[model samples]
Target: MPVRHTDPPPAPSRAPSSVPETPARTRSQKVADSPSLMAIVAIAAVGVLLYTVFLFDFGHRGDWPAYLLVVVAESFIVVQALISLWTILSSGHDPRDYTFNEAQRALYGNQVEQTMAIGIGMRHAEMQLNDFPITVDVFITTYGEALADIRKTVEAAVAMDGAHTTYVLDDGKSAAVRDLARELGAEYVAREGNAHAKAGNVNHALSITTGDLFVILDADFVARPDFLHETVPFFADPTVAFVQTPQTYGNLRGLISRGAGYMQTVFYKFTQPGKNRFNAAFCVGTNVVFRRTAVMEIGGIWQESKSEDVWTSMKLHERGWRSIFIGTELAVGHTPETIETYTKQQLRWATGGFEILFRANPMGRGRALTLDQRLQYFGTATFYLVGIAPGLLLLVPPLQIYFGIAPISQDVPGLTWFFYYAGFYFMQIVVALFTIGSFRWETLLLATASFPIYVKAFANALLRRDQAWSVTGQKGVRNSPFTFIVPQVLAFVFLLATSVVGVWQAQLDRAFSLAVFWNILNTLVLGAFVVTALKESREIARASRELRALRRAGREPVGEHDEKVVTPVLPEPREERRAVAIKPVTPVPPPRPAIAATQAVAAVPRRHRAVAVRGPAPRPATRPTPLPPLRPAAPRPPAPVLPSQSGPPSISGPLPGLPIGGGPGRARRSAGGPRAAEEPEPRTAPVPVVPSPRRRSASGADLAAEVLSFSGDSFSGDAPARRRDRRSR
Candidate 1:
């Protein structure tokens, strides 16, 4: 949750009402984060230095081919480590300083309100620039995403607490989406063709909508109510071209989603903040705010490449426009939850990096980037190349297994090699722990499994062609995840065979081989990814089978999407159900003189007459959970006496109707004068039944039914009215 923050300004300032503010880093957090970051850099620097020393030692060289491969891969790894450490060292910068905060405070003034009716009669706070109201267009770019997801994003975009127009740019030409936009009161944008894919969709919106500053949110990214307040203030700096927030996600339910999210978590939390110091923070196609003039100056958003975001940002940077990347999560959406989506996403991003590295190098001629920007962009270009190293490194064990060849000279003891290896790789894990908070094994698995994607992206860039893929994963008919991870399966099989041979060789020699162990571990790592894909494949097949069954039975109609995609789920255990079945519950106090609540165990309040939450029905084989003994209700408070009353009012049937066992009747101030003041008409009370020997335990619903069905003859009442009131209650 966001907190309220107020800082005394040097001069007094006026604002319209109040706004929720992002939490500011406390002095303790600043103190703790700095030391932790430096520690990581220090430890990582020493490890890389020692590993480089061990690698370059001439005496450790073995076979030329294997040795050269090892050196090249390790060199790239070392370069990546150096860049990461440098970035971590510069992670102390916060783009949102006093200026940004002050600008945010003055974003809405009380002098003149700027209101636009959006989203079913919703209006927002004034969006001001220099205390003058400014126009902002919030664009949600969609291309074949689910309509429900798009609706959520559009609703949020319109409801944002700022005077802005929300538009849904539907590149899929979806009529349903257009209707949804109309129903939501958001403008609908459709184009004749998706010439440049997402970039074209946005550019088309740019042509007609004339907002001074525009925000771009992906179809699934839902902006927060204060998103405009957060990013719009950064543009107060005239030179700032855009404000980019991290692409945070809320749907981390699938393994693929978790792995893909973890892969970028560090970049958003640590690297982007560090990049902001160099004014090299780039837009990521979503959750970004761009100045219209800066974008117009760079022509429309660059549409030649798949990654128009980085390409456009490069053009803006070359044009000498500054960019800001805030580390805050202003909007959240879903990350790729399937192998096909993950592969396509990674491929596109990597291709963009390589294209920038080659076609229009930031470090090359005809550019106006500073030294800091040059180094940061160069790092970005080479980041994906580091992914290629893992694929090459996986082959080292096989080299030793197939032929008696090794990267390290036999003269070097195994222990020395292990120590040097640990210094680099083990220390990297420690660095991840410090920087990313906790080390995630899923990240490692995804990283290792995704090398083929990077390799394919590089190949596509090298060939100057697109990696055309018409995957069918998101309609009624779905493709198996295995279709996308063929390389991983082949690699796993080869490594497994190599490990088997290595194991046999070790057995024949009556000795242990580190190569066999390493090969086996790598094989298992790959196997885990294959297993994940297999699980997804099974889910897709199961969904297809169920859809077919539904169609055959004529119980459901055909549709473009199978809403019931069988996600991987585990069943609840029997113990939880038993516990829930035996749990106790009591009603909260009512506004009456007779039935006051008791402080019994597990007495749930009746805010809405809560149905005690319980798990599924328990099994007969499981141990019977005996219900706890019921406690007696507390005595009702004595009715207050009115000074006008002559004597104590005559009592009627015991308290109009206890919820348990007491018969139905209304208690009164006098026998027939009038009912108690502020009292509602009487209803049938409940019955409390002691458990029979045959009963194991009782569920809340069963007990509540018994309590409401009480027909006890203890008190006098009209039988028909009592039964009718009981049924209704």
Candidate 2:
């Protein structure tokens, strides 16, 4: 049965919608998807050998204490490097294998001949998996995020191409969020208390809705329409628990957001995909889809830890459920736009890692994890110890300068030390370059300055303290970067004073001490951090001042907006402003025998929309909201959607917010609302301009005579204008 936008009703026997099948990948194509893995491995192999040679070189041992510190610090780095190398080696494995392809084909089998119906009023893309209808519920977990931010996310979530219900799980308890959800045709969900923060909010939603798979998006995330289509097929396998996609960021222009985003980019690009081969791919909270049964099997999202996402993944793994991480970016959202948000985010994540390390060891007995998984999870648990290394290393130069304690003995020549240092550390930098394409100075700076946060997180975890974030954060009241970097400032002051003292000592001895040089380097790194923080603080202050001025002037900044109460329904793929689908290069001739001639010819291909409004629509809402303002013009009655004899076939649907002026037919409408017709108007007939009689020609008939003859009255020589017959094929 063919779906038609025409007035006729659809057949009850036909399935509502379908997904197109993806062709099977050949062996060569599969290999090509991961072409760079082998080069990375080859380089990493050489790097490991060089690292081992330098690490075990005992001939250059200094004072035993200093040597011990150096050994411990360097060892932490090398271990992480090699573990990351292992993960990157496994990154070549593609999750979309033959099994996923077969499932997609079955899901794609629904519509024999179809037209995808989508627009503002009704968004539905119903499909089948394993011949069973499945409902997917999208949960957009939001706290006190801006209303504008929430609207953009909900709009995209509802617009995503799949059969799903979009719910704004507003733990913020804002009435504005509710109104925004209503305005956008999404259901609003609110709860009394956010006990477990994000996890608790989602768990409550899961209880109310019985969807087979639930997609969790942060309040800021705007999902691409195919977000579900890309991840849902993996659920075709009974054992797979969840599918994780990369948390890509669109707000990386800011200093903090850029650094944070790049840091995550590396992991998403390399670490997560590799974890898939071990079946240890963990969820990062957002941009992930989970099977309801799998989440419920683990007693809902784990509430015992702030890092509920990781703990939930662990519990599922212990229950022998597999996880998959697709490296593709399915959604783009905001990263930490300010240092305050960044600090809190890192602290939360680091705390979770420490909690896992101390509380739930993946390698512990009575576990179901594989050896590959145990090592990977164990590595994750111990990963933040690397952060501890930076704190310890920062103190080494001060110790050497003030107390004559050195990690490297005077026996090691400066030239020899340089070779050994470059072998391990430089090789690591090279690996970073190969993996992420380039080294990010912002990432490095942030990482170096971030040890203080990690150490605090460790202490918080060790002491069994809960990290709390202020929910009462006032807009434009963000704290300065100084609030988060007190420790870094102290370290900078201490390192600077030590460097001065070391320089004085070196002058007296008439020697250029390497310890002094190293101390100066550390001081500069800390100084750079302090300088950047101060600069950011100034920028924040300026922005706050401007905001205050705006408030004083009684004008608040506008955020995301929507169309009026009634518009022809259309959900377009992600673009700048909403737009009509691009027209076909050649016009579609007309509906053939396959399509009923009564149906209007569609201008675009089938696309994802949630509930496509077809057949008889209910009476549209009577609220007569005015359309967007336009320049004054003579009133012309809106064209009927039906085929017209005078023009080409009328456009099938309202031209969605097209670049050209949207006609009266494209009234902005909410989902489920039919466009209300305009009040009857008497259209004034257009008068054809008569070209004034040209200057009298010198020939037989003057121009005025010719014009008079061309009118309805026949001329002396005239026959009716001949119609050129179109040739029949």
Candidate 3:
């Protein structure tokens, strides 16, 4: 069972009013006292003493070599044990590691209030000074990973609800991967060359993208939608640079995978929380959110170190930037299954750690690394080098007995030496078990088994070989050849045979017999590690055959019971989404009393009028030119006078010298003056009617004179004159 961390003392800085301040609880009150724990510690101490005193022996005074061998082996154990004991005791005093389980959280009275306070901070950060939404970029780095595996992670990221964008930083530059990103509705960025592996890939991505806060996820790690919700609130503090969550590998299966996962659990649960107390908690490379400014300040994620995450964290801390490690498992991933993959993974970590120690020593003349931080970093950096002790200890006894060479010339007292050696070892285990909150024998065995690999890693790191990144064994497993274990196997066999022959010889003294037995135990331990490797390879081969058979039968491998393991297919790309602008609703003002049309017009400006007219201009005019004067008529022969029946008076000779329809009674005015009508002209021309022949035609002047006379007599506007003329005609 995982133990909850006791709440640390409240900070002097005021927590948000929303997060009610609470007094800290003592560790004893927080953790219920357990009798079983006390019992285990007592039993372990007794067992160590009894085993050392009775089962093992110090040789006679003549056997000086036996003493030397025991001292050499014990020296490494004592130093490491002392370091572990001190760390555990100090860490347990004020634990920062915790579980989020309900019962555990109840120990902190203000958890809910703290949660609300964080939520409020998130709201503030989300709304910038100008109130525009903050941009968050989620970058999933990939290099030729299976699309199906990465697609799940991408889909999860896209499903997150926030002002965030998800990009797949593909270093492989595969067209198929680009299509996959498009299909999943994620932006895909590919670099031409992998300059510095993952760190370089991320730096290149950082250059092109613009986001206020960025999240990093490995291609296989699927994030919870609420990852930002839980994490971003912590960044409300200006000092916080990044937030790291546990890399929970929930998909691990089989013994090897489970064992590897357990080791991770110990680190995330115990080791990381302890580091957080010193403000030395480093990024674990994935499922971490970093402030853009913080990353930029660190010179773009430290390209020099293979373990960029640690180096980045060290630099950031040195620069006074703070980091946070949340114990929640918000994202999950896979662990290496096969022995070869597992060893490679461990070696890579070991190599990177040593590289940091030598190339850029955190403990050396660094800027602002605190004393506690230096020790913490030193312990981590030198962990792989310590594996050398186990290898040397395993070889010590076999060589001592095989050749008559001894490093010591005299033996020491048995009970005193046993008390010193066994007591240190047992006390270390007790403190570790108590401090870590839980212990698993399998985890210890796994660490013990990896000693040979660590020995090789230490050598490699010293030689500065294998500095580049290699893919972890989470990929498909292969049948591991036993060639990798030949040295280990030889050591195991030599030790076992040496112990048996020494026992059979009967010339060996009690001290020599005890040495043989110790060698026997070392052989078994080494053999167990070899067996683990062999079994892992065999299991992978078996799983491969089973998978192939299932594939041939046109069925996917079942996950649980008869249920199928279905991989999510990428959704089709959606049409571009246009942002819908929303207009604000405002209250309508009440209308004033209606105004008259004239008043309304008066109130309006001329420019604002519906239609406005400019001033009218007068047009110029001129008198019509006088029509050409009517020409005088030409002389013509008079028409034959028609004999007239006498009614009023006889008219003849085409009514000469008068208008065509002018009344005979009307007076006419010559150009000189008005004249009275001339009534009785000579009427001797009243002869019989006869047709007159055609005579000389009238000139144009005569027609013109006739038209003018008609116009003057008929078209003239004198109504009475015209009526009288009609009556007479």
Candidate 4:
């Protein structure tokens, strides 16, 4: 649905009346409606049928067994391809599915109204002046995160608008962490043991603090100022146990971050929303708000497993509580910057997910989850188990080529197989890119590259190995050698060697060429992963060096240039200096004595106003010198006034109390010597223009003495002497 902005309704009683007319929907919509998609699927289907019927000459083919296997594999691929198309198309049929990019707001009208009602109820509750304010407790769990990183998140959390208190659960028990919490005015809590890692630390917090609502934030994930306002209101429905917002990463400069982010895009944007339709949106470890009562009722965060978030959500759902997936990302964090960290993070999550699947299966008997909910949990658990497929797919072709064990007989027509496979592959890629937000072809390469990590995780889970949680080193250079990507490297090598041998042997029949083409293609895909791993390692090293440089320079490290996370929403409290250095010369003009008196009077106590306003005035020793009067110019006749008329201009006037236009001893000169007053006289000496003094070079003592002497005596006393000195010069 398109969102249109307009003036809000003046009255709440009236419905929103200015919204644009909604577009009409088609009477029926189906997968076939998409001509391009249908064309690919149809082509793929026909190609598969052609290959199965005409290409497979089992009687004469030397590699008949391998050819038969290839046929079966292609058939399986076609089936899964169709299933994917069906799933994607069917997903859109439900009105509940929403993406962060665009939302069908009309479908969530009831949820919006209830959320508004929650706000209204809070306002009414406040009006009653009751003792209870909805208290929200935010827990930031950290092991050994940098203080600078933690400061940004903690500051933002404290700045969040609500009746809330932030707690820094320092599992590492670092004094620096404690001091930072103190500096930020947040409560700091530490535990004595690391029994269940972050989950245990949170449980410890639950035992100590109390609040109506609880929020869990990873050490690096920073919440928006309005996070509580946006998420907490959903709890108005008593059944809502928690609200989960998408966890977005702020930095995506590195290959590792970009690739990992692509994988997350699918889950948060597509899978989570689909799960929300059935109220099966499981909690993602952070950026989530939970009802305190609901958590306590569910026995706190499940301490038995590292995937406590999933287990706890399951328990809550089983107890008839609800969860909401807000699809919107109101918080942002950092992604693992190195291949090793990324792999380790994936391994831990994969292992834990499988642990939940085995130990506390949601589909177990007597569980209260609906059939849909059970399937959702099962699907989530099995997600980690399916990592082995890419590895197997990578292996089959290379092994068949090198060992002369072709998966399909040469009797099979290669073009039909290739056409069908290509069609399905193309359509699937298109649909995924259209549905999921981030649709990069490079992401497919990255996904296929991560096969080794998945295989290792699966192996760990299969062996029932008890894995402990190891914090993902959020930002650092951990040398992830090519060895970490052994699977891709080895696969690429095998495929390359096998392709060379097959071409050299000149088994260049259509089927042989097809097999070579498929192996080479898979090899290239695996090679892309190898290159990405190398790039990721180099990026991690560069990032680490840059980070260190920034720190040494006393500057904050840069993340995404445009989308930096939690940049200290509320600035750190500026340190107050005990003594402020006042410049010798102030910029502000000094207040006049009279105006200052008035201001002092206004500020002083009533009885002291008179004393403040009229404090004893300093007595003047001598009266101020009166300025000289202006002398009118003597007129010439009705003719021009000659230079003689303007006699030598007086640069200095007579001192105060002296006669105007003349000294006490000198007589004034007339314009003409008592005779030819009507005629103009010749120009006399040009008026002497004495320049102003260039600089004052008086010493401090002399300057002080001059000021005192001037204040004590008038300039009249020295006027004649100064005139004599000027004349001598």
Candidate 5:
């Protein structure tokens, strides 16, 4: 019998930085060779050829049924190809150019500038290494994490290059960490209350330690030998507050983990450098050095908030201190080795980020924060909201498959769609290529697959009444379908059912056949996702079991020793220097007030005061008093009478109230003539005066009449009795 050979177990996935060397594709070579473009061309060619064949066959057989099916298939392929092409084209960025030397140089320079400002500053301070030999306190925070992981980190901290004392603040209360700490000659600080989770643990450490500087590390991370050598000197600067180092991962044993590491590199090595360039690099909750004075000044590490690092940093910045981001990845940490943990971590981050946006925007709070600080704070908090975009995009294709409802109309001719959609598709490819490169494609696809889940998680977090921090379970294990399986299964079932219904409909009518193909394709894609999810689920379960067993065995904990390390205590307020004040000089007398020049002005006021006049002083007569005016002088010779028409003399009595022109029975006036006058009769009419209501005499009545006659309108020359009669009427 022939010997049978079995395949060896797969090697654990290595970190991207550590991937075994493949033949390197040079920049020029990659640009010249385009596999994506070739695939697109091939797809387009097949589509056109199939359409041509269908067109000819339709002409020959006159069997529109077969021809229609071919046309539909051909159309779908062409449209899909064109869409892909268009996306690649419209992305506007050239992936090939992104990897070019010049682009790399720019990105490198940005990173250097960022790292230099923060990392160099810290390192330079460290170089001034004080032989003060102060005892420093180290806090390693753990939550539902495996003992082995905790042990690795604690052991690494113990090996730190300084006279440092370590403390393991285990929220899980695992004896493993306590024992490991004991073995490593470090202190194990366990807390009964885990109210704020990691923050609570760290604060507990703070209460017990008397160190001048606190080095905080997450349980999953191990410190480097030079961690203290590179960071401690930064505290020498009285103004230098806290120092933060980039988080780096070592082994990436899976595709997800590898992708996450790559993202971190780009973020820390590239984006972080840029941020640091502007003094905006923020803390990542681990590998941070805090000044004891500054921490205490702001009430120590904040435990009330979900994200303690951000909350504490905000307070520190508000209190007029500085933070630095050391570009060097000085400490080694672990990525989520499986997809479930990876997703869980991302979800928790997203939820926490949203919490900050809703609750912690410091803009309107009237704090004395710089514009740069505000932007940095807001940018850090709102970064996770970007996940909503991909979540929305995922729903689009699924909806298109399930219902024949396209978000955009697909009724355009095949050729029109070919160029338009192909260009759009090409644009996206370009953008992806430029931004993430090929290494991240799988991660992007997985992210796409989990988009809906992420969206739901975010929405649920928002709606839930209680906002509590739930640490992602990082122990590598595979479990049953209960965690991530049920959703996948349900999605698969729905997708499968839709596909079957689509195929049945296709058989009945050729027009609906395209719908059937679309549904079937959706089903296949969903099925792929379901398989991947199950695999990840199993891995998580296995890791969980391993972690539980390690806990039961009770391995030694890191940071278990009780030795106390003394650090430089900050100076008391009385010992601090105070500003000196100078004595005030005596003032000279002010200039004397100026005196007025004239007493003559004062004499004028005295004269005016002495000349008070009585009311109504007698009026002065101008020389001659006028005699009574002569009478009207004989009516001034009767004014000439104008000629009148002779027909019944036009009955001209006071001209009735007619205008100067004549109508049927009226006389007309000519423009040139002047004439008709009447004489004034008397100054006053004879008075038939009755006795006044007040019983006054006739002389008084006469005086009243004289006054009335002098007044116009009422009685200019008439009797007072007539005026009185008119008033009565």
Candidate 6:
């Protein structure tokens, strides 16, 4: 007989559907497809037309109010741009005879001194470290994480070929990890209460473990085998308590990761070392080894805030403990895999670091930190505050484009612009070259894209609101619809509206045009962010739905799915016994030699059976070979099991008649056969069997079964009766 089978659902389409192009230019189309280049052209055309009209119709007005307005707006833009430039240029010290450019100076001028101090301090600290013996303790902290990923970190730490003790602080209290730690002969620590997140975890280890110095390693980090050997020798100075190495991620190659890492390298390797020459090396959160005594002297590591590292460093410095910045990359950790996670991490650090500045300015009050230390901490805190700068820039253009209000009044003398505005503008180019000239294009774009989000986040931080940390989700593929596209949409809309208004009002001039142009430029820069955000949101939503369905189907652990699952009320739980539906039979010749291949082929399509009881399912048998008691068939009168009544015909006879160790005929017989006979004589009624309402109370059993089935195909070979028996025994 010819066999038929349902084709498998077409694999989900990965290629995104193409967005339809805008047809002939409608009003909405013009708005949506508006480009920055187009905006610039439109604004320039309007400016020329307006100038010509003004000269002809209202030539040389007695007051020159419009002229004054243009001059005033330009003056303000020039001054603001210059001041910003000066801030960037003065922000870093040029210790190695390094030169600056305008953009670099504008970006970092204000931070130059602090960067220099830290660099000077780092150099001095390194000189002092030329002499102390150091033993390191590497602590890897973990919450609930995949065992494989955690194992990779553990292995890296354990492989460190030096006088270092490796400890895995399992926050999840996972026995598997503990066992693995034991196997690797590393210290295993599990805590049952508040360790208050990561800070508490590290502190708990500090109190218990005995190491000359402590090194914090995140669960996703991999320490070089020679990390301790290379870094420990630098702690020779009795005054030096710790040496912080840069946290690098060898595996991360995303544009965002590279951009952020480039900045870090500049700060830590170049700027920080210069600052260290003056005793101003500050503590970074991780990949740093701290002196046991120094930490203990400060009453153990501080857990007062989310940024415990900074808080602890403050107290340590107050007590005269010194820190140094080591330029080498000794340990590697996973960078934010997704933009969402990256942004979250940045926001947390920014907000928390700022809070430290507000609450504990080592240099501000009569605190113990020295001049250099205070400046270092202040610089660290100011990094976050800088996020507002771009937002301010963004607002400037919009204000000029929307309203003709110049932030700087035109009443000021024109020559002041030469010294203050001109000088600042020139310095900005210098600073940009010095700080981020290598990735000028990308950095500029990112800066522009980040403006809105940065503004919103900065405002949120000022309000002292809580922002939960989110991990970026990436699968070795750089793609996300929301983060990549939504910003573009918003930017397009803003640019189009502003451009049309500027043109209609005939108010386009150099100042007005520049404002409109910059805004449009910013929109393009942020386009990727919007698309990626949307895609991330959609993926999260889909995952949540799947989790909920699994929970409802009684195929997942209760609490595991509780976080994502949505449960609906049912009239009552039903005992649903459905036969395992096997896939269609594939013809094969009968042969003894092909038995092994046949078995393997058959295994691929075997259907695994599972029954969902209204309440709970019976527990599995403890003994391996013991069979469960047979459940008597229901005692109701025999009913007809015709082809249609049975739901569908199977080529094989009734499932009950098939052999427990059925052969190839079972496959052929089941292919589109007639339905079983549902009706039987009343005299031959089957025995009544009702499951006892009560069953195991544990909710995880069902989930555990499902997980096992999916993970290892454990249920594929069992018959329906055997599956029930296995569960009940």
TM-scores for all predictions: 0.72, 0.71, 0.62, 0.60, 0.52, 0.54
User: Which segments of model 1 are wrong by more than 4 Å?
Assistant: 1-16, 26-33, 111-123, 468-476, 555-729
Put the candidates in TM-score order, highest first. Answer: 1, 2, 3, 4, 6, 5
lDDT of 2: 0.64
Residue 231 deviation, candidate 6, in Å?
Answer: 1.6
For residues 15-78, write the lDDT of model 3, one tens digit per residue. Answer: 3443222225433223323444445545555545554453245443234554455555555454
How many clashing pairs in candidate 2? 19
**Candidate 3 ranges beyond 4 A from true positions:** 1-133, 404-410, 435-439, 474-483, 506-512, 539-575, 578-729
lDDT of each: 0.66, 0.64, 0.55, 0.55, 0.49, 0.47
* Candidate 4, 488-604: lDDT as tens digits: 687778777877876665555434555567677777877766777777667667978887888998996543112212210111222221222233332221111122333333432
Q: Which ten residues in a row have the lowest lDDT in candidate 1?
A: 1-10
Task: Give me the runs in candidate 4 sitting further than 4 Å from their true place.
Answer: 1-132, 362-364, 409-412, 475-477, 506-512, 535-729
Compared with the true structure, what per-residue lDDT tens digits does model 6 show for residues 469-495? 332332222344355335435765676
Mind sharing the TM-score for model 2?
Answer: 0.71
| Candidate 6 to truth, TM | 0.54
Q: Which lDDT tens digits does candidate 1 get at residues 1-729?
A: 111111111111224433556656743236336776687678879999998999999899988778888998888889888887787677677788787888787877652232222222113454666554456778888766777778888888877766677777765656577667767767666555456677766765554444568899988877777778788988777678899988777777777888888888667777777887788888888999997766755556777678789888988888777899876667878778888888888898899889888888878977788998888888888899888888988988889888878999999998999899998998888877766666778878888889999999888888788654222122234678888888999999999989889989999999878888988989999999998998898888898888789988987753423222121111111121212212244431222223323421123212111111111221122111221111123332332221111112231222221111111122222111112232233333533445343232667654444433353322223435655764565
Model 2 worst lDDT window (10 residues): 608-617
TM-score of model 1 (CA atoms): 0.72
What lDDT score is found at residue 12 in candidate 3? Answer: 30
- Reference-based lDDT, residue 439, model 1: 71
User: Against the hidden true structure, what lDDT does model 6 obtain?
Assistant: 0.47
What's the distance in Å from true for residue 207, model 4? 0.8
lDDT of 2 by residue, 1-729 (tens): 011112211111323344433424432234324556567566766776676676577876777777788788778777887888888777767889887877666654443223343333213445446555556778887777777677778888887765577777766666566667767767666654556777767765654444567899988877876677778888777677899987777666766667777877557777887898899989988989997766655556777788889998998888778899886656777778777888888898899999998898887886688899898998888888887787788878777888878887788787887876776677667766666666778777787888899999999999999998532111335789999989999999998999999999999999978889988887887788788788889988998899889989989675322212221223211111222233433221111112121221142222211111111111121224422211124332332231111122332443222111111122232111122344221122333324333333334344334443334333323313311111111
Which is the leading candidate under lDDT?
1
Candidates 4 and 5, the one with greater lDDT: 4
